[model samples]
Target: MKCTAVLAALAAIAITPVNGGPIAYGICQTGCNAVVVACYAAAGFQFGTVIAAAAAPATILACNAALGTCSATCATVALFAPIP
Candidate 1:
C-alpha cells in the first residue's frame, strides 16, 4: 500500500509541466550564494538556458550603454552582478 502511494506521487511529478523556469532569489550583492544555489536548484532542468536568455535584454542594454562593444562574456558578468 505504501509503495503504491509513493509510486503515484512520483508519477504525478513526472507528468507535471515545468513552468517555474529561472527564479532569481535574494540579493546577490549581499552574498546570498546559498539562496542563489537553492533557487537555481528549484528552477529545474532548463534553468541555465532560461536564465541566460532572460538576462539577455539587460545585458544588451548595458552593452549599448557602453557604446556597442559588448562581448557576451562581459555582458554576462554584469548580467548576474551581485550588486546589479
Candidate 2:
C-alpha cells in the first residue's frame, strides 16, 4: 500500500508542469522534493498518509487551476491525471 502510494506520487510529480520555463521547472522540482520530504518527515515512511496529507492538495490545486484557467488543450496538457 505504501509503495503504491509513493509510486503514484512520483508519477504525479513526473507529469506536473512547472510554473515557469526551464528554470521554473527546476524550482518546481525542488518544491516537489520539499513537499515529499516534508511528508516523509511528518508521516514517517508510510507513503499513504504522507502522500494524502501533502501531495493531494498540491495536485488537486494544480489540476483545478489548470482545468479552469487554462485553455482546453493547455489544461489537458497541464493536468493529465490518472484520477480526476
Determine the backbone clash count of candidate 1. Answer: 1
lDDT of 1 by residue, 60-79 (tens): 33433332222332233333
Please, what is the whole-model Cα lDDT of each candidate in the order they appear?
Answer: 0.33, 0.40
Model 2 worst lDDT window (10 residues): 69-78
**TM-score top scorer:** 2
Task: Return the lDDT, model 1, position 31.
Answer: 30
For residue 51, give model 2's deviation from the true position in Å: 15
What TM-score would candidate 2 get against the native? 0.31
- Residue 28's C-alpha lDDT in candidate 1? 18
Across 17-45, the per-residue lDDT of candidate 2 in tens digits comes to 43323433333344444554455445345
